[model samples]
Target: MVTILNEQAEVDVTPLPRGGDGLWLSHADMTRATGFELKSEGLCRGEICVPVPKGRHDFARDDAIDIAGFWRYLGHPVAHDASRSVWALGTGAGTRRQALASLEAPDFTLPDLDGRPHALSDYRGRKVFLVSWASW
Candidate 1:
């Protein structure tokens, strides 16, 4: 399960559900999970070895492989099952690999709990560690 953002910007990648069964993802979730620095190369913000395809279309079909398209043609399903509505794609044609790229933390300004604008870039040149916890 990969969460993509901007389509032109790099993605942020992180593990799902504290070692749970399924991979859960969202645009904001990806950025916070991965770390800042979005690119098309599909590598972590600081590390190398991630792989993303170069072309936008399948070439054979001339259809674009935008996030949703990739999910469907690969045999995955996007559905609403009463409990949840999920959009999931397969790893690949036949490989068991999980993701094509790691998520990159995104940078943006949004209102905080107090309605003040929070700019992610404000932390530039500083090391920031963000941890996400949930009680369900």
Candidate 2:
């Protein structure tokens, strides 16, 4: 089984014919890992659709899709620790650029000292002072 780390979730899917850097998953596993369904139009998640390259054998074979290869084809970042069987996928550069173009910070929720949940949106419309420290 391989664990895929996406923006909002971590999904585990068994990889078929396990070898090489490519992460091949079945149709159901693909959807479970990436929320994308292989369609005649390409990979579609809701209204968003990404056209699969024509004659690209590296992307799909025998009902399995190489998600890592497909993500690379879309110019997205993919990081993997094969020993750990974990992969992390990042948003494409274009998506990051568009997000950066918007000055507003994305909303996120975190627990406070008392284990109370606090969301960034909760402090919206007011100046928020944030201090973060992490031991690397």
Lowest summed lDDT over 10 consecutive residues: which window, candidate 2? 53-62
Local lDDT at 126 for model 1: 80
lDDT leader: 2
Ten contiguous residues with the weakest lDDT in model 1: 57-66
Q: Count the backbone clashes (under 3 Å) in each candidate.
A: 7, 0
TM-scores of the candidates are 0.26, 0.76
Query: Residue by residue across 1-136, what tens digits does model 1's lDDT show?
Result: 3433332243444434432233443334544533422356642346642344555433111121133433444444433234323333333433223332334455667676798887768887888785556786
Error of 1 at 8 (Å): 16
RMSD of candidate 1 to the true fold? 13.0
In model 1, the number of clashes is 7
Candidate 2 per-residue lDDT, tens place, 4-97, comes to 9998689999998856678889989999998899899889999988876666657877578889988887789999984849999888988778
Q: Report lDDT per candidate.
A: 0.42, 0.85
Best by TM-score: 2
